[model samples]
Target: MRSIFYIFFFCLGFIGYSQELNCSLVVNAQQTGNENQSIFKTLEKQLTEFINNSKWTSRSVAPQERIDCSMVITITDYSGENFQGTIQVQSSRPVFGSTFNTPVYNFNDRDFSFRYLEFQNLIFNPTQYESNLVSVLAFHVYMVLGLDADTFAKQGGDAYFKQAQTIVNYSQQENYKGWKLEDGLQSRFALIDNLLSPTFSAYREVMYSYHRLGLDVMSENAKRGKEEIASSLKLFEAMNSRRPNSFLLRTFFDAKSDEIEQIFSDGPNVNIASVKETLQSVAPMHSGKWANIKF
Candidate 1:
């Protein structure tokens, strides 16, 4: 009976700690010298286990349901315990009832600075900024969750966004660069803050429609899905008219630019000239890329 009880508890613990991210981590330490560069190889293994094993959400994510994402940290310079580099975070979710996986979030953070000692455990305290590397990873984790959730349901990611906001609040207490509002409009603060604000509802709506209604149904009903996506583009048009060249809006285009062109390659239901007009009006900076809209 005691063995049975122990097994039950073990299963319960596994369920409780089931993480949702299928994350791949690559730690590039080319900038550092060969003397101690082998340490980065160790760091890579540790970071992978830390991110993949740590449960970031309470949702019961099945093994197959784990979100697919990758983190590339290019360590350009390191000194003993100090490390400096950039991290590129990318995540994509499988569309419902389809084989297609759409990119949900992609961000390159350039202002990463952290300290790490070999064999030290990374304690991820969500409510506090314990270390730059963990804090940054935690922030991006929440952002990815929020963005992925928003794609499935209308404003479904509010809880995750609020959680990210809490991290941002915690980060402000520390002396970091990316966590500051004065860091510039492209800072981490701008990204989440804009996402949560009521003013960006149109952008969030685009997220919802572009995925759940648009990409998800493409295989089953191409016309209907294309209509959903094309109609959703008008939201960006409205956003640009209301708040031109917004940070989050630019992020939207940055993520979808290539996919957008591909989607319309089938001669979608959208009017090409009208599409050009909207693209030029809302996200004109990407106008050169949109030149291929030859419909």
Candidate 2:
């Protein structure tokens, strides 16, 4: 009975500590023109381990249920401890009853700048700003978490977004470019601010309706799914009417334009004339992809 008790406790402990993200990170320093590649390699390895191993939330996420995400950090300039570059973060979630993974969040942060020493420990402390490196990463991670959760349920990501907001609050005192409002409309501050704002609530609603109500039901009913997807896209009409080509709308299409195009071009055809119009109005930059949706 002692052995059985030990096994039970061990299993419980494993479940309790299950990490939330299956993230892959790549560090590119080719622009630095440094012959010594060891520093970049170490940065990649350490940051990869830091992000994948760290538990970002209290939820018990199984290994298979972990969110799939990737980050590409390109170093444009590197000297001593100071590194300046851009990071492209993307995340995807698996569609229900399908072998496909749908893109969730795709963002490029041009203001990524930080200091790091080789083998330096990377830790995330939510209450205070540890470093721009850690704060930037943790903020994006929460954004991915929040957006992914939004796909599964209506406003289910509020808690995660709130955590990201806390990081923003803590990091604003630093010299980071992305954390300040004056950085630009496309800055990280704008992204999170737009997400949490009541002005863009339709963005969250469309996220839930498009993925959970639309894509998740595709395998079961392709026609119904396509119809629901079109209906969900209509939610953006009201948003676009007020904001007219907002950053949040652009962000949504950045991750979903291809999928949206493919969904309407193939499978069962539904009345998408209005959705296509809304897409062109809100996400005109993706007009090329939208134009290809011949259905």
Candidate 3:
């Protein structure tokens, strides 16, 4: 009897670590002006459970190996079961041989709208359109997985990004704002489109170089790591020359600007003359942050 109990508990512990994402989801309804807050609270709890408990990948992951991510859904208006809002999704992965986690992806999706009842089951269907809420959440979950995977290997995120693309394909036919080509440049459609296009291939290279060759090696050899990271920044120049002021470029900097500043600010001295120029040109919006990169 004791052996049977020990085996059951061991299986439970093992299953707990197999899920891929450790996501914190916050559903903010302050702007809605709805006095009854219980529904929002219930939505947050259910969505949190849905995202964190669902197995996102086929690969087994230990607790420490799960990708750390977040979603902030700000409800701008609500009427009946309809919700209109924006969702900010961000994710990060741990640096090798260190306690630090480097931010990998940050994106604000502004065209979010959905319908939900308090106790409706949030199930994700990859092959078909279920609900905009489930589709959007699942889409970002795969995106976070893909982006985190890219940081570890060259083009390692292909499969996951393809998964996100599939979600886009499935959701476009629905009467949603962010899932079609005409839905503006920053839509979920545009994001997945740009990621899969061959024209933006260099972006993935930069991701691999900046994380694997650069930040991951910093603990043991800060100078070499800094140089690798600096070199990675130059890859963006060619990308910028082709498509200047791209959504992908802004997305990269959104997650990395502060980290880039801190990295070059206090590091073993390396020539960043050209890289600094590249930064000013490719991501001018982050000019203020770049101004502080002393090296």
Candidate 4:
């Protein structure tokens, strides 16, 4: 929590053209590897370079405004050129007037399996089908950009989400596993589908309020900022009540539960019990955290 300082001072010293995503990547192959373990090392280097060096969006993002994200790929099984594993994708954005970087997306996806040849260049084409590896990485890249854009402006991520939709549409012609409607409710299809759906418009509004109005204002006005966040939770409660359990809501609480607890620990003079009740009603799975939120 202490590291959540504003970067106002830090940003003053840096200026340059930077890519949209500053993604720190890791490929863990200790658990699963075929006869030749050397391929994993090459895989790590190529993937790292691929993600950091690729220009995801056409818009030129300034150096300081680039998104901060991490990708961890853990191999559970490997044979020949076929690698099986999970990928953890997470991203954060800086809060206004504060040094804190708020978590926008954090997910551990087990629905990934791709084949990689040693020293093969990773490539992505938007208009055609690519390998599952490139498609998956590209999908999350848009998601990160989209979610980050939503915080700053209302439905500002439409272009990025539309890009992801294009990837999903193109992947349907391939034999991939994560891009279909029949892939179940929590599939990647459902995530972007729900976001782009008209039914979930309120969630986008809550995102803007929670980040731009709520957390961003904390350093300058803690009480009002906290109130805005608390009010947005009421909006969350209403949405959850209307739709019941949504993948977006679950994803929201997943990324935000701990931060919500930390922000309200002892700073606000508002009704903590009311806030607790609202949270518990919407996210009962996090009862353990809300249970400790008194006063």
**TM-score for each predicted model, relative to the true structure:** 0.91, 0.97, 0.96, 0.91
Candidate 4 residue lDDT tens string, 123-197: 889778778899999999999999999999988899999999999899877766779999877878888999988
In model 3, the runs with Cα more than 4 Å from the true position are 1-9, 12-17
Worst 10 residues of 1 by lDDT: 29-38
Q: Candidate 4's error at 124, in angstroms?
A: 1.7
lDDT of 1 by residue, 1-295 (tens): 9999999999887765678899999998766655355688888999999989998987876677788999999988888798888999999998778777878888988888888999898988867778877888889998998899899899998988898888888877667788888988888888888998788789899999999888888878888888888888888876677788998877888888888877876644667677677777888878777788775
Q: Where does the lowest 10-residue lDDT sum fall in candidate 3?
A: 28-37
Worst 10 residues of 2 by lDDT: 28-37
Name the better of 2 and 3 by TM-score.
Answer: 2
| Top model number, TM-score | 2
Clashing pairs in 2: none
Error of 2 at 65 (Å): 0.7
| Worst 10 contiguous positions by lDDT, candidate 4 | 8-17
Off by over 4 Å in 2: none
Per-model clash counts, in order, read 0, 0, 0, 5
